[model samples]
Target: MMILVYGGSGSGKSAFAEKKITELNKSGIPLYYLATMQVYDAEDEERIKRHRMQRAGKGFTTIEQPKDLGNIALELREAKSDILLECMSNVVANEMFSDAISDPSIYDKKVSEEKSFDKYEGVFNKIKDEIIKLKDSCNNLIIVSNNVFEDGNIYDDETMKYIKTLGDINVFLAEISDEVWEVVAGIPVRIK
Candidate 1:
């Protein structure tokens, strides 16, 4: 079954996914966590460390993939593993905004060009492909993504474009997922 737990920022999607993973583990089902975060700064490093400690204590195998999740998903299929992807939003952001973070000058130039935002679509496509393949291959597939559209007001042109692309991707994924649950106040309520 493909289960998608999605909600706005701080809506407890990660907590919900973790709980489901724990329950699956207790049931003697093998659980593999495909983590897509790479710590690049001190804050990120600390976050990764905390996540590692949390999952390590529970024995969930973690495969860190920051850019190429499709490759990792392919390998997991060959290995025949059941997996959970903690969150897809960060993964998309990492791939879409990686260069921007390194080159601050790109954001400095106030150019009203759509070309600047083209990479987001490609990143979205990659994420979609990987999720489709993973869902088909795995025994149980659970994907968590932030339901960010409900609460945000995109004022800036660049930010607005990014949010639109992300919202479109999220909606597309929700359509394909066997079960879609929206989390609110640390509780999951099924939306589809």
Candidate 2:
């Protein structure tokens, strides 16, 4: 079963997703917590630490796979497992720079040739295909994602590309998911 849970930041969606995954685990398979967040700052580090604490006794073996999801199934061949993709936003953001399109910290005077739009589409497409393969490799797949499309704000082209790509991803997953949920103010509202 592919369950997709999504909401705004601080919407308690992650906790909800974990609970659902734990409840749906019937085969006693390994629960794989796919952590996609890249720690680039102290705040990011602390957030990861806090998430660890929250899931300390959840009986999950965390796998840090940020770029490639297809290889994840290869890592645990023939062993039945359940997977929970922590969030799609981070994965999308990391893939945006997967090709070294542009790095603000390293490149002061940017001179790149790669098309950001083409590169990002390729990244998203790969993620989509791998996610389908991952579903076949696992007993159940619980995906967590952020709902950032509702915010009314103007962003630069790069940020817009990320948002648009993530939006497309969410729509695609919603169509394929067995159940879809949207958590608001710590309350989960089932959308599908």
Reference-based lDDT, residue 155, model 2: 92
Model 1 segments more than 4 A misplaced: 25-30, 103-118
Q: CA lDDT, every prediction?
A: 0.74, 0.85
Compared with the true structure, the alpha-carbon lDDT of candidate 1 equals 0.74
lDDT of 2 by residue, 1-192 (tens): 999999999999988998999898775688889999877789989999988988888888999988688898777657768888989988888777644434664333332444447866897898899888888888889999998888799897778888999999899899999999999998999999
Where does candidate 2 clash, by residue pair?
none
Candidate 2: segments with Cα more than 4 A from true spot:
98-116
C-alpha RMSD by candidate, in order: 2.9, 2.3
lDDT of 1 by residue, 1-192 (tens): 777888886677777877775665444456788887766789988877876766666667877776667787677776556688877777777766666676778656534344655566787787788777777767777788886676646576666766777787778878887889989998989988
TM-score of 1: 0.82
Lowest summed lDDT across 10 adjacent residues in model 1 is found at 107-116
